[model samples]
Target chain A: MSGMSDKEDEKKSTKKDEAEIVEENGLVYVDYVGRTKEDGEIFDLTLEDVAKEEGIYNDEESYKPMLVAIGKNWLLPALEEELVGMEVGESKTVEVPPEDAAGPRDPDKIKLVSKRQLQKQGVSPRKGARVEVGRQKGIITNVLGRRVRVDFNSPLAGKTLVFDVTVKGIVSGEIDKINAVIKRRIPGLPEDKYDARIEGGTVFIELPKESRYIENVQYAEIGIARDTLKVIEEAEEVKIVITYERPEELKEEKETQEDEENEE
Target chain B: MSGMSDKEDEKKSTKKDEAEIVEENGLVYVDYVGRTKEDGEIFDLTLEDVAKEEGIYNDEESYKPMLVAIGKNWLLPALEEELVGMEVGESKTVEVPPEDAAGPRDPDKIKLVSKRQLQKQGVSPRKGARVEVGRQKGIITNVLGRRVRVDFNSPLAGKTLVFDVTVKGIVSGEIDKINAVIKRRIPGLPEDKYDARIEGGTVFIELPKESRYIENVQYAEIGIARDTLKVIEEAEEVKIVITYERPEELKEEKETQEDEENEE
Candidate 1:
């Protein structure tokens, strides 16, 4: 009986393997580390702990294995094309030229502004200082007397990029896909905190108490709803449930005050 | 039959009057015109057309008969006191002393700011011109050479006020009370567009398409829920539903594209 069951399990595993392979329009979770080829400095990564170890941890972001919807313009074209046809637990290293990445730098984007003007605007003119002149933001390359040279192009405009990416897994469950969409908006919180589920055609997301009062949280809710409609085609509506409970300290204090009144 | 029905209507009208009259905590819709007794110029009013005709129209505000919860501090303490024990369609003119209205002006609030500094900060300081010095906003009462005298006091300070108020009606229905809570947040949209209902313990509000993308709409939704909980005693949860539909113009275009695809 054990030998018969093992052969049946082998066939089921083979079917699952074929279905889990990456293709266009498939949802896959991946871990990636991207850096410039020129300096080999790590610029971007998916895993949070790795980002912290590399000293690139961003407080404004929550890092995790990203859910990439293939052929959705969610990643660089060169890198996205390389991800196709990869199986679960597969790894690939892709190199992208400047043209395919941030586009080649234009000489016209580099210009000189008055050093005295920068000082008046509270910008201390020094080499490699970041500043915004008028509307363009750039890095100050040189400060020579009254003249300061600035480059308004993308910081990686002229550099080739190297990305080492690993396919973590495929998100096939309906609930997992919904959580993936929720993570894209309320990204500061832990992935497990967002309680996302789908019932019939409506997607419901219960925001954690930590995110109930975040800045522009309503905007984030609207975004999650709109993005879910796009990512989950069968989802007809999204209901974001945000419950604002009275603080425990306040509740306990109120109860204490009432008890004192009762005693009186 | 006509005579008997008329008698029955009279008995029903008496019961309605007993229920509709304003008292402490009663939600009443009122129209009010407030002006300083010292200068008969209107300082505040409720009606939109009247406000526009009087040249007091504010683009940032929505004008309608205000929902006033008597004794809830929704108006001046003196004015709020006058609203209690009022009846629907009842009109009253109440006078308020300067002390009971805007507090008496303090001389310490009047001070001189440097005119040269104002000019340097791009403020052309002239007599009666509004200016903000540091964190205090004030009117320039006098501009003499380099010294500009600014009065950082309430505009209605030291002014005796008179208000001609009329109670339009009382909001007694559950839906109307819910609408009052919603209108407070989405004041820009017309009242007729909002569809609010109470189902079991949940209060559902289907937001108008016009309000789907308003500034801070999520904030507005949250406020509506919190306010409803406070105002509607039976509402255990508030569900604000915002639906974004494809624009009519785009829908037609997509239909045409689909028809062509079917033919192909």
Candidate 2:
């Protein structure tokens, strides 16, 4: 970005003098702890040590400052709305009503099924077992002698949520922001794995070797391009490169086979 | 390419004067009609109308001149080997032995199974019903009340094959040749859907919109890049772009929602 002209348009209603503030469509990294209002029970958080203490640590999850695109609903709508106008390193506590979060629990979504029918659908008729009916993931709350009750509402529904959130950083600059956008779409790999550059209005991305055989990467490619174009105004195009290079060992492995086939 | 220096390296044992001839790793297009030597049965051919006349038309196949990467085994090993050193418009009839085509029929491949066992494997015990056992596809030869006979050998394993092949053209020039490689990997889409270009040492591809939701496009991306690098020789890198643009209708649909969320 060339000095004055670029920053002026990106700035909107800045409360502090010469400080980057959050705005709609801005990419920001945040650390947050979400809890239910009824019991103040921590359900989700970004700190690994805290999760370990709370007995909610998952081996597969990478605990990092969550990246959120404001106005995109990556967070609860109420929480995201409160993030606007906040500056980097700012901390705030926000209360979200059930409507703005997971929505009020719908009694109509609950159903009772015959035990035989549940068994026929391959669902074990045991209490607390997870089940999916009509594409809704539900919990089998009760298993009577001949009938089972399932609740399809989301676990957090109908409960107000409270969050303690800190804006760690607001992503700036073209390429850094593009990398952030890429990390949002393809989260399996670290940001350092991808080499990104901008030249002649086109953004070039070199994907890491591990992504070459990943299934359905075309969706990630489309999402990356769309999100980059929507957030990074100057990026005219996004190009991703996935390379499969033969290592020296593989070259040696094919030599005997090459010697055997002179025609083909 | 620096004209004279490059052509001298690519040319290998050319038979004709100033005419580009096929060599090892060259890309060529061919039209062929494959027949069984036992009864001269028309089994496969590239021409669609001929397939219809012979009562073997298949709606799923795209009947175009077959693109073969010489020495890559896209065809039978003997057939691909014969493609080397051939020039455009040359026609030849080649006879292939059973061993070279599909391997000699194995006597041990014939097996008898109970009809109940075939039914358990979800195979109908009718004569000529296709069945797959232990990853080998076979056809049922006889069904006797409770006993069934299946031949695990390939249908053409014991027969000599004849192919009337004509070399239609050799794919030359970097861009045209790169498209061919792309088509070879992502066969479901047309070549024109991807706009490919080479700048500096990198090859850039713009994938079609329909490919975004395909189940396993990463495999194709890797295959295309590897094949291009191995066959094209000049490409040092490959970059692919997939774009998802919001149409005017979708933009109009979101305006009301945008107006409602000013904080986000």
Candidate 3:
């Protein structure tokens, strides 16, 4: 009887693994760390401790899992390809060449621009300053007496990238997919601030009182709706709900004052 | 016959003056210059040349006549009282006592706060910088070693103010009043960005495409609606219309490409 039970448990585990394998056009959540191939210097990471140890932790930002739609070109082509068939709890290191990454740097993209031109546009030219010079956006590589050298190449160009990607989990369920899309579009929001419910192919998002006046909230809503419809095939409508309330402290003080008045 | 016509014209002009006289609760527009009574130094002015001569010309801000709803406490009580019964295109100089203006400056309002406290609160205490310390808003008057002096008193307090006011025109008509309220709430918007039209009791405002995504536009809309109801008794509804468009340069380029394709 023990041997028969062990065989049945192994069969169930294999079935679960098959179900969790990443597929084309599947929505996946991942925690990733990106490093330069040459020196292995960490450029980006979603893990909090790894980011802090790399001296890039920002208290203002909340590190969370990133949502990726496979085969949609949301990520580097090579990286996305490698991520395919990755099961939940799987980790992989993908090496991407310069061309497959941000492309190789071109010397011809560097040009000399007059400092006065930048000043006229209210941009102060300084060495290592990122600025918009004419029609091209570039970083000021050098600032001279009357001219500045602006390099329009991508900062990570000419360098191969190595990404250590871990599939945290596969986001399944229509509601979870909606939440994942919202998380991707409007990241750094606390999980409790919004609640998502789906009924009859419609998604209703309840927004916290404090989030109604957030900057670019309308854009974020539109982005969430677009991405939700793209990922969740059953969702046909997305509605954002905002309920107004006085600030918490003010409301509490008012309630206390009213209680005192009633007692008197 | 010429003498008879001239006498009749004189009577007509007097009647016109009586009709155009400013009244209590009347909406009026004015162009004014505020100067220090002690030195006749211009402190503020709507006239470009006067502002230029005073070395206070700001190229970024648009200078235009200010709108006033008399008896609304929008202006200093003394100044508003003096403006009553003035005629259109008339100019007046009103001297307002300190008590009726910003009120007397209180020395007790000035206090020294530690620079470290300000820094800890992420407030940079620069000399002449306006900052909010605790619950009171104040200006930094001095920065000493380890301490900064903040004065909560108004900058114009303890001094009589002199205003050279000229009534540019009296605002009449429901449409004009609505426009004035919008201008008052959102000053410096170019005149062509929005067009307001009234139909029945509803006001339809066509907003520029660029303004639809502007920050605090919702708050501005609420303010305009509130002020319109207060000023224009006939208006009952304010509707904002937003239209989207491709950028002009991109649209033009697309059209040129289409033209080439059609030629082929």
Candidate 4:
């Protein structure tokens, strides 16, 4: 009887493991706290009050809760790898090293430019002058012999950063929003679908009847959607569906429809 | 000799503590990231690619790092509270409950409106649609009798969220930019500063002496200049120089000048 009970326990454990894996495939939601690794300064938070108080808003709207999927490079590789097995409603603290966080600062990034460049730009490069070139901004670290050294390395590089993160909810929804989010997150995916639905907390996407070779893409897209929705909803119960039809089947149906049109 | 060694150890410990504090202060810069705690999924890393990415720009500049004093409530209060005494180059994970994170879903924020109201505003609320109202976007959870129950609760409510955050850099110089960031981060500060600078990685602000009161309100204005300078090198630094000659002092000088004119 004891052995039987142990076997039952093993079965239960297996079931739980399967459920966890399935849950991982669903949408994920989370809350987080971020700080600079160098100074232990908090940079961002999802807390409503914090967002409001900090005024990180668009016309008074706080930064919306962010969403992403597993296995997609939407986040740093280190962060993505850590999120793989997280379940809905589960919270975890993961430490991302400098390489995984923002990468180490590179000395090569810092460049020195002549004062003539500053004069051409109509800027006075003082001992502590800062300037922008295109999208990059640099502070004048030293003004020596008409040359200004500017550091382009990320300020937070080579520092270990900490984050207190909570997986809040997962999203499993209609095809349009899901696809929109996916496209927004991963720009490389092609756009072609016939119908889509979310049922029993899962998303089902169908391909056009004339389409060919979609099984692998379907699985990958579904997995991506599942993980993204999980982060959006911060919930565990998300499902996805993908359907594809062959071109031969579509051609036959079209011929039949042409015959019917003639009969009519 | 033992006492001397003990004294030297004490000095070394203090030096280490000071270095840690300096590191913390030096690690100021800005980046953007999105994550959830419940699932540990990161959706975005604005800091890493802010300059490279094109879409997330405001006023033709990407959102870069801005400085916020620790415990200043410039960010989420919970997140700010978590950052105290954190050493530079170290990362840690913190968990913020719903109350501290996104706050409990507010039922009062949920409302039902007639379809006509949406039509009046040129909005179409479908069965499961999301709409924006006055800087707040709510999702349509249900529709009944021309009424739509839109949950104003953050899309991330009740879920643990994660943020792979790092203090990329501190807002050290550019008083105008620092002041602008401060105003955006913390309102109610006055705007009276005429000059702002960073020396030895510390922020220095100069105010118009004519203004009898120089309060935090000025911080926000200075922050704006600082931020603008961060993006535009040609932007000029603010300088407030008050040269006041009291009426009594000027009176004697003027009389003497008049006597000289009469003699001439």
Candidate 5:
């Protein structure tokens, strides 16, 4: 009986392994509906009707929904954890609490700033308007004489949010499109060696000579690149080429291209 | 005096337009420190404290920071609005409110499920441990008796997240990854007749049969071919040949290649 039980356990483990292998890099597409918990207001939806009305995508293509890997951080951490073992072609509704979803609101995050700062920054602090304070951005919770109260808290703070997500499809590929967006957030990467590409539904990036040996560079690049690529779903590769060409050199290259085109 | 005022307005508009252009597309790199608003906890940091870490990036290479575009949805709307018109290399401390950040928590989003459901699904529910429920993969909030409570809220909900973001660099290119990612997300795309290439940072995708007055069959072939070519980001040009060969004929070609390789 003990041997039989052990065999059963092995079978379960084998099945689990098979499941993981099948989902290793397959694409999963899904449609989702998100709503605010407090008022049950529909905040976001991947449905065609709502997406079309909201102009969610720049093109007029029908809403194709979002895609995510089961164990990947394609979504938020908590959300990704929940999606790790789901099978394709399956649909289910999920309910999340504040802690597991967006978490409870923090009161200390609310602050009042002088209107002079707004003026200095050439911004008008209006009621119910969102604003950026300091180097980070915040929303205007309220406005009073000469003072605007902004909450640096998340919009869904203290409110329950519901997501009706449908797994649509799944895919796997190398990393791509990392440094392009990362450079926009950070700064000062030499131009010559950093490159990114997407191929076979994967994102691939090559770092600059300066960053070739950094472990964190690889980690952060891979992490953010993977997440960003997952969000887009169709990206097979994103290549970012880092170099040290001056602005004038780039301008010259542009002119040369134009000259060639004219000749053609 | 009226003419002078008009001229001043024109200058301001031009300045704004230039700023918009700069903000619209560019590459940047930065160093950042992230904090949670709930209790002022430092959740993440890009700075490393060791010499070995510094060596990873070679010369003054730091961890690549998050990137954002002024008018793009890359950053939160509130945050992007604030970043507009800011000079490069400028440093500021920004605080984001929960509402504008992740938003408040909600109670209605929490759902209660039965232990029988867990048993049937072969999952063990533990207290304080987050678990996914249903096909949507909602996070589990709590386990009580026969019922498990779950939350679908965002983990960052209602928390003011702070970032010490820097503007690093600027770049311009076609939104190649975005299109590729979107295409990959949707299934059943034609695999022929499509060709894509990146030159001068712009991505050009060509559909052979759909070029102008091609027939549906031609279009189909082009679509299939293009889909195949889309996977190759380095190919300057792609040629697709559609042949009405049977499965046996294709097998014969493969066998011939194998025979040649074996002979070699």
Candidate 6:
């Protein structure tokens, strides 16, 4: 950044005047409120206050802007297309069709199973109750004598999705782009936990301390590296570092020393 | 750090000089290579090179020292007691009795279920094969006609457990103490992803970006804050912040400008 040529430096200053647009492969940060188009029942939100206002204030979940890599399947095709050519701070409401969203509801996904099957699994199936049938999850639509009807179609399927989105920022740079991929593979992590840097076309990421021992984080890390190489073509190697620190011992020693000095 | 008094400064210096000993509630870091006591087959290793040598090199998982807070039940009681009073860099081998490890094997845990039951769940059971039977996991020991014998006991239940333990470092500082609790709740994370700092008894933690979207992470964050207050005592408030960076937008503008200059 400090070694820019005079001509390049001049261009940097004026480039902001030219509108920056979202395009394929561009990473974008967005603040969005998502709802069902039919009823407008809030399904998701990236703002804390809004979540609070909606009576969905979850102390465990901290809400923030979501990062999306354009042209990636991270977002529905309809939503991604609507975001393109948008500028920072620009806001728009996009409606996504069921086909482009969760996909149209399939009647074939519904099945009827014997009540004994649910009972054997210790599930007392009642109408409108959510339960897992075999490997698929579904809602019990009806219960008749010995048979229970389960609908496996996604609840959002066949319904239009409405997203109120604001383009907060667009991402670029080798390090930031890699971070986007990491964020996609591992969502809901805070920003600072990521340590992404590129050296000599290689990317190094230090997984945050809280992620180890997770059931399949090892596989996820490998998946991230593979996906990063595919999307970020310049990344030749992806190295992950896990660091654990012990700072309490020093604090205890200091406390003990302070206690001794006070006695003296 | 900049505003400490002369007395505080003196205490800090002497703390490092005092002979450090492991104590109750003291956090310790250790590098360990665990193997089966009977056969000496490597089960776990914290060094990458060691893992590579043992033909267990996994590119996704980074090996590092493990942090343990004494009396926290993170490690087996037998292993935790062995670590107490041990100095940094001290190494020891601990053998845990079956009662203290995964617990003694229970013959009652073995059962015979009809092969039809497994087929109904789409599971093919064979002798010595691992399979899930009605939420309980077991190893098939025999297939007699239409019956499959399954053992539900833990794999290590009857085995004498062993651990090669080492004391790597001790933890200090208020933030680090809180971080250990967070790490316990969210394992597999690196140390830097934590942004815990205590100011006027209130603890502020900015959840790392990769952690926010994880299922039940919200509960984990809330649990961490509650546990921090219960353990740290002085922490009055726990505030979590989720931040997203758009460094790419600035970088993109600069790159576009650079491209324009090259064209000229």
The candidate 2 chain A region of ten consecutive residues with least summed lDDT is A1-10
Question: On DockQ, who's better, 2 or 3?
Answer: 2
Top model by TM-score, which number?
Answer: 2
Name model 6 segments beyond 4 Å from true.
A1-19, A180-196, A199-201, A206-220, A241-264, B1-264
Alpha-carbon RMSD to native, per candidate: 10.0, 9.6, 11.8, 38.4, 30.8, 18.2
- How would you order the candidates by DockQ, starting with the best? 2, 1, 3, 6, 5, 4
Chain A TM-score (model 6): 0.73
Q: lDDT tens digits, residues B1-264, model 2?
A: 111234543564344532356667677888899999999998789988888988898999888888887766778979988877776667889899998998899989999878887789887789999988778888999887799889999899989999999877777778888888888778878767888888876777778768766567777777777677666554566666664555454354356446666645
Question: How does model 5 score by TM-score?
Answer: 0.32
- Estimated TM-score per prediction? 0.64, 0.66, 0.52, 0.31, 0.32, 0.43
Score candidate 6 by lDDT: 0.72
* Candidate 5 chain A minimal-lDDT segment of 10 residues: A237-246
**Taking the tens digit of each residue's C-alpha lDDT, what string does model 6 give over A99-207?**
8888999999999988888888899979998888768999999998899999999999899999999887776666767777777777756768878777776676767
Backbone clashes for every candidate come to: 0, 0, 0, 97, 120, 38
- Looking at model 3, what is the TM-score of chain A? 0.72
Clashes of 4: 97
i-RMSD values for every candidate model: 4.2, 3.9, 9.2, 31.6, 18.3, 12.6
Per-residue accuracy of model 5 over A1-264 as CA lDDT, tens digit each:
111234544665644433322243333555777777668676666687776666564454445556554444455546555554565334566666777665788999899989899878888888777778767668887889999998888887777667777654334333222433444323356644455555665454544435423433433443444444443344533333222122344355445645765897
Report lDDT (Cα) of residue B29, candidate 1.
Answer: 79
Encode model 1's per-residue lDDT on B2-114: one tens digit a residue: 11234544666645555446765566778899999988889999978878888989987767788776544568879988887876767999999889988999899999899
> How close to the true structure is residue B123 of candidate 1, measured as C-alpha lDDT?
91
The CAPRI-style docking tier of model 6 reads incorrect
TM-score of chain A of 5: 0.53
lDDT (C-alpha) at residue B27 in model 4: 22
Question: Clashing residue pairs in candidate 3, if any?
Answer: none
